[model samples]
Target: MDNMDFSSFLNFNTVTVAIAVILLILLVSRSLQRPANVPPGPTGYPYVGCIHLLRNRNILEVFRELRGKYGEVFGLKIGPNFTVVINGVEALKEAFVKHADDFSDRPGGFLAEVVFKNKGIGFSSGENWKQNRTFSLSTLRSFGFGRRSLESRIQEEITAYLDVIEKQNGKPYNMKDMTVMAVSNVICSITFGSRFDYNDVKFKQLTSLFAENFRLSSVAGAAQAFPVVRHLPGDLFSVKRLVQNFEDIKEFINEQVIEHRNTLDKDNQRDFIDVFLLQQTKNGEENPVFDDLNLTTTVMNLFVAGTDTTATMIRWAILYIVHYKSVQDKLRQEILKVVGTSRLPSLADKPDMPYYGAFITEVFRMGNIVPLAVPHGAKKDIHFRGMVIPKGSFIIPNLDSVMTDPEVFENPDEFHPERFLGENGQLNGKEKIVMPFSLGRRACLGESLARMELYLFLTSLLQRFEFLPESPDKLPSFDATLGLARASKDYSCRIVKL
Candidate 1:
């Protein structure tokens, strides 16, 4: 009986081992396999794909190295998702502009499911995106989005910004908090029809939430790529916190929406919120797309999108000026030459300030704030430049590649504002190629407002103060803390009133 049992056990063990070997082989083969004619890329481990590649590395640097090895268009299997990184100006323009429809969808995964839930302008796709975008652009334009009329509102925030900075009294101070406040208020004036005081506790909390989510969202890329990561026992990638932040932001927006609805005067529209409420009332029951949820999400998208990014860019601009005193001197000189010290700089002055324009362009390039603009998805199976991009694959536009391309800008690494100028010291048309707002249908919706803010704020600050380092010997590190936006490491500068 014992001999029989031993033989049976050995047979059972052999069967188990055979099954395990077969499964391993199948997994390995499946992981190694690639869709036919897809762009060449690194084949990562089974199931996980190239997730480990991004574990400790900078994503932009990783893409740059991959571009070197795999050419402009490269692929990576990020978990179960197939991602294609598009590099260079020609390829980006071709994919985004030439074939805009085919490459305009936002990938549906963790971000879409949890954070955005297929709502809002930033992440929604198809008819929903079309309707919202069309209405948004039209409405924003009506309210002076890219027009000269909006300059006065932007100037209001700048005055508030300057007053707060003046309180610092030339002692070394980090401009981040005040900058965020001022920039956010610009969005507030347009969206909520009111701007908050710098010390408003609720407003401060709201902005803090936006800033935190920006950093957390960037860190949650792994969760975004791999939905399974979000299911882990603990909030390993801060996914829970991110979702909570969204909920908090949504609640705050909902309150504003409720208030707007109560006070909404359909005959006399005041702000974006008032217009949206009127539209909702007009299309009640017939148009489900213009519901409360969409209103809340759209407002959230505009508020968050309009605030953090512009603030970060302004902060980067300040850091660059502080680091390069020569650039600062030149910028101030140009501002003085054009706008003069009598009043804050205006959009009308923009044409005459070529050096200032070049300086801003250089900041956009060197800052590379939104390094990889929000990931776009393949609307369908796309065939471009002789390679197939499978449907639903993540399309990453490496804006860093285009901005830093040596072919386009000589000494791209060096922060030389003069590269944007012609022999006559006027902005050469090269500034046209500097696409910090990105390109095509899915480009930043707030580009005009952002440009207006950057120009006015930077010029005003330079017009009034000299941004000197706390210590001449120890300039703030040009190194950036990478997030959804590239932000300069926090540094205080001595702001001397000129």
Candidate 2:
């Protein structure tokens, strides 16, 4: 009887081991499998996915190569997350514009989870995003965004910027700090109802934090992809620093919010904070979208999204203008003819100066600052272009592909502003395809403000100064250092007062 019982126990153990093995096999296979009918590309390893392909390679170059292999719509699984990269103008427009609702959501990752906490317009989605976006847009328009009414405020910052530059006395000086200071101050004026002094310790610290966080975000993207990395011992991916920087920024913004709340006048709204505070009162604290946290996060989004991108574009403009002296000369001639040396270029002059318009278009096209243009997410299971874009996949709009498409821009490789100009020197409609600000519902909230700043600042700068390389033989490198924004390498230029 004892021998019989031992044999029975051994049989039970064997059955249990066999079942465990089968389950293990199934789990591994499940991890390796791709969702049916998703866009086709590399079927990378489980968990890590195609992230290995990006190591030590330019992301743009990698995407271009993948596009060559996988067509316009391709898929990449990055660390358990499925990402779909959309290339070509038609595909992009279809995905972002035609199927706007399906692809209007923002992806959740380290950025949404840690940095933004799904509070702000940039990273948040659903009704919260819609309400905040709608309210912000309406409020911004009322305060002269995308209108000539706000140009005076911008011009005030420009006046201050030019004074700082003039103090340089045409010496070799990197315009990065001053440019960021000027650009950030515009957002400050809109948000805080005032601008900070250039030399103000807090202002400098705040701007530096913005710039540092921008750089760190690119590194922190790893943590975004593989969240496990964020939990590792050291801050290898800069996640800790990024979070700390964000906290510091939030604290600063929160201080402004507190001050605004105390001084807010319901009848006389001074700025964005005042407007938001008044709305908060109307909605009451229980309202999810207009709460204090959302207010701070939204303002943080404005400063972060607004400051770096516009400033980087300005830097790229300066670099390109100096690199292409002929383009610079022509731009100056147009400005001189229309706006003249006596006063800064105005929006009225913008209509008359097609060349200058084309030049800006070319800069937008060539600079491609926000190359990926903030990743979008599939709101639901989307059937796009005969493929299944599974719910929660990261949707990347490759603006670089559209901007640099040979078919769209003839000889897209060359830095020719005339591509945007017709034979009659009018802006050819090709500028419409150059979507540096991206497209559709989740398009940049600060688009109008950015465009206005770019036009005014660049026009005014060219009107006042001739940007020359540090030395005749040492022109700044045109190659951009890839970060959250494609930034121009640090290069000083002699800003000869015109």
Candidate 3:
């Protein structure tokens, strides 16, 4: 061989050996880096961790596949973040309930730093979170959050939405915006003491921003997992868009807060905003938790969370009923038998409608919205189930795993309401098995309100209208476009008055 050719071959071989040596060193170092009791997981690449595996994969599907290989508790390194996913009911309860404080803090990363900023009750942590959560829950409860007193306001929106549907004249129409408006109005009433028209310019702008935010926030999850990429230009990913969305939402909320401040009455509190204003005034300069920033973020939290989630579930309910004719007929039959057609359904009627309750339970399970419940943080280092959860490590309680556990629900994949019903056809409190609202200390605060909305809205519609797919043979796809919520694809159904 020529001398130059021989030299090139030698150089190539030398480079190859160098790469191999570096990789080996990296593998060994990563193995050594694991603390004593670290959870088992697939070994990721050097620096980037499992980012390559996660970049384009469906996160829920990835978690499910990982659960099969690593059991209920497994660790994943995406970018710079090391996250431990706790799947199934027992593991979830063990972490979130038994060891609540350790797993209660919100994980800090790009999302927390940028979008959330640890301001509101939803994602804030420590004593600030505790105080805000307690006050907000109490304030909401006083304003008829879980109690029967709040039913009238919800029923008002239900009646308004039903009128809109009835005006559709049984023709095919997309239920997305109108349905969201109906649900959002309840939140508006509670927070701002009023409801916006479905077509209001500002209201539409707000919901539109919220919808975009939901999609972008899901994208932000990647940044949370791998904070290294958070610095990249906004044009490359949704993080930039997510930040803008929050700004817009917060601006709207600030405007509302200013309005409430202008008309504050010491002895008279109309709704949540008034109560907050009073609290802020009472605290004056001393209270850090009741200021304008906290108020804006909390209001934003209530709306952004309250609107999309319950509305999406209601939309899913209609889609399920349309896809399964028997379920639709049975749900309608139950509604008729329980509440009758003379007047609107109320919370009082819920106990008598076991099938309805059971159906809602099945919907929560099948909807699998929030497939991975909002990521929690390890408040401190935790030794859980023979694994070490490092302080500040992200904790994901896979509610989907619990809801669909074969032990908890037979044939979990199939959409069967009967699984939630007892042998005697009564709702046997099996709804507890499906936790769409999450659980323990950090569980959703608006859960009671959401539940009441779902029952009243679904029952009201079924009492007056029968929903059917545009084509009897071609039902709307049960498949969801996943994000923070599993929203069904936009589909039009004929809402024939019965």
Q: Which is better, 1 or 3, measured by TM-score?
A: 1
Worst 10 residues of 2 by lDDT: 143-152
Per-model TM-score versus the true fold? 0.94, 0.94, 0.91
Clashes by residue pair, model 2: none
Error of 2 at 315 (Å): 1.0
lDDT tens digits, residue span 295-362, model 1: 77888888777777899898888888888889998888888887789987889889899998899999
Q: Kindly list the per-residue Cα lDDT of model 3 for residues 383-478, writing each as its tens digit.
A: 887778888688888898887678888888899898777889987777777888888899999988888999999999988998988877768887
- Score each candidate by Cα lDDT: 0.86, 0.88, 0.83
Candidate 3's TM-score reads: 0.91
Residue lDDT tens for model 2, 404-498: 88888888878888988889989979888899989989889888889889999999998889999999999998878888888878889999997
Local error of candidate 1 at 29, Å? Answer: 1.5
All candidates in order of lDDT, best leading: 2, 1, 3
Model 2 bad stretches (over 4 Å): 1-24, 145-148
For model 3, the superposed segments whose C-alpha errors exceed 4 Å read 1-33, 145-148
